[model samples]
Target: MKKYLPLIILLFAFIKTNAQYSGALPSYKLVSGNDWAKAKNYYLLTLLQQDAEAAKLLKADAGLAKLTADKIALLKSSLAECKDALCLPAKLKFTDDEINTVAERLAALCKPGSALDKLIKTHIIPSGTYFQFQTLAPAQLLEKAWRQDAAAINHTIAVYAEGAKPNYPQIDSISYNVKKRGYYTLMYDCSAEVNETVNARSLFFEPSLKGALTYLEVNERMQAGDYEPMATTVNKPAADKVKLTKWANYPYTHIVVPGAGPDDPNTPFSGEGMLRCKSAARAYFAGKAPFVVVSGGAVHPFKTKYNEAVEMKKYMIAKLHVPASVIIIEPHARHTTTNLRNDARIAFRYGISFSKPGLIVTDKYQNDFIMNMDKRCLQELGYLPYKLGKRLSDTELEFYPLVNSLQIDLDEPMDP
Candidate 1:
């Protein structure tokens, strides 16, 4: 028996690793901290809530039952300063043992690389005082069910309202990879209701102030191109820069160059992005394509003042000596999801049925991601707008109406 101790410990560890946490979690209400802390906790709780709700829905899903069961159990027994309201000590010096002593399994469930941890990585870390987990209810959907029937939602609040301060379903933007249609309005309404009914600040993001928009204000924005007000904030190319020819009778397919990073002042364009732009130029000189579409915005390490497509266009004209007339500037995409979505958006706004999709010219890794999209990508982006093959890898990609037709879901974010 003494000789078998190590093997027994190894077996126990394996079980813990694979074991699903099945804990009954309630709606969390954190005593608000700093902006980063609040935002970080907000998203973390949303992730936890989403999983919790998902576990409930998948109770009968044979494959997921065990995993969901494990999650549920772990959550119910997690160590906390206090069960419902976790109030840290005034000095806030919490050793692992101190935290674990309060609630045995709490820290392990919320540890880094956990499912909950992955979801909240969007936030930048502060000085050691941050943590991150949820399942969503069916009726919580915005478009078909809840938006269609506001009364249904009100009834839920009426039924669940407790002690004049009900635990309502939350609707925070950090929970989603991107916002869907009516997201802002729905959040605005739900948040308003929470404040008015429960006398608490709305956990969800509210788009507008001074009440919901009248019909005219909504129409004015919708009729405009892409309907994103924040596009105006993006840096534009020189006023005199030439626009490319329309899609119809444009002999060759456009080579799409999605922007990579900020341009270096010392050199024209440096970094992996320069390689991507150079790749596009090489394809252009080879006569593989006629036009080039440089798609990117002031993405990452935000407010760097360098537009990826604009810098690429400059590099193309000065370095590669590619014709300026052939390049189309799509200067508002913040992510790859937007990279594909923006191309289709700009195309339709310019022409009716001139061409299908632009041929995407990007790095090998990015091209592979587009080619072999996974579940998380599909869920966040909603669709892959372009068709990809080896011929298109780092050279070209096709755009289809089915994908382009769906709205770019980044309808609203706190930042543009």
Candidate 2:
């Protein structure tokens, strides 16, 4: 009787040890056509904790705990909101992609010294391995495993979205004003032209002749009384014309031109011209207030347009009489949208207030586009103040003609 008792005791101890090694059995059997992926994570985590190494991995830190809880709550809410999509078992099937996604999320949550972290660091599991698990035909086992891990699945989605939200703060408001007579300018590419000039003499002579022709034509028409010199025609007038209304109150003006260098043939006016324009505009509005802004950035590898803002500002200050104190240069903007967004931000930061509308000066063709883009940007940035005004217009031949000539050179090469 004593010997049999010892045998029974030894057997009992062995059974207990085996049970502890396998971990607790999953709470339920895997259901067919049901999403068992999340449950599987629960089971794996439980099983992993059985070993000391796994146990270390399973210990959640405060950051992980808080994040996991928040994520779970969000997922629960999202799931409840999307009951129709989530409730269907068919929609829940564990695909390899889904499993990999969950795994990656889990890995991100794992702490550096944890057992789970070790596993991830050592294992090169492909993203879509969950679907392969289904091939084992252990549906009942998987369902049981997944059921236990339901909480973790919810947490993953919430955490991911939080991390992915746009980090840039949305602009709430932007305001700027000219304290005294000064100028602000916005320029854009309009059209382009090209004329051969052998030297400085030719460059000056040819444009002068063209200007003279334009002036003569205008004077002749005026003398004949063929047309009235209305403000709308002679200078941009206040009308429903989208361009004029856009800049009606924003009296500051700047010039945007194309080409690579300060003296690039594309923008014959050059950097000196930009500075002179700034100084002249500032002097004209003398007591009104003055602030100069230039917007443009470097061209991308595949982009055709050189950054006009940087080039324009550099030339405006270095070659022209414009003081650097009054000039704002935006060198990061790559497109019209960025130009409006970033430039407005700079203005807002500097405490520039706009009691009257602002001014925009660009090539004729770009007049409409810049005006509209500025309006849209202001609206987006939540800085809808006064309408912009068309402060000045340069001759089409000066900038537009040059841009047009370069399109063929700028287009990407076609595959033969």
RMSD of each: 20.7, 31.3
* Residues 1-416 of candidate 1: C-alpha lDDT, one tens digit per residue: 99999999988855553231111111122222223211222322223334543223223333334333332232223322222211111111222332233122223333456442343232211111121111222112111211212222222222221111121122111222113444344333333332343211211211111111111122221111221321222222311121343445443456778887744433434477778888888877887655677877654443344566778878888878887766777766666766766665444433323234456778888876666663534665455545543444444555442223223232222111
**CA shift of 97, model 1, Å:** 43
Candidate 2 local lDDT, residue 248: 35
lDDT of 2: 0.32
lDDT of each: 0.40, 0.32
Clashes of each: 32, 54
Q: Estimate, for each residue in 1-416, the C-alpha lDDT of model 2 and write its tens digit.
A: 99799999988866663343222111112221121221122334423433456443323344334433443333334333433322221222233444444444454545555555443323211111122232222323233223323323322211111111111212111111212222121000000011121112221112212221222222121111111121123111211132232333433333223222243434433444364346444542453235555655443322223445555655666756555555555544444544444444333323243234334444444555654554554443233322444334542111110001100100000100
Q: Which residues of candidate 1, in runs, are more than 4 Å off?
A: 1-252, 262-269, 352-357, 389-406, 410-416
Give the total clashing residue pairs for model 2: 54
Deviation in Å, model 1, residue 255 alpha carbon: 1.3
Total clashes in model 1, counting residue pairs 3 or more apart in sequence or in different chains: 32
What's the C-alpha lDDT at position 144 in model 1?
Answer: 20
Leading candidate by lDDT: 1
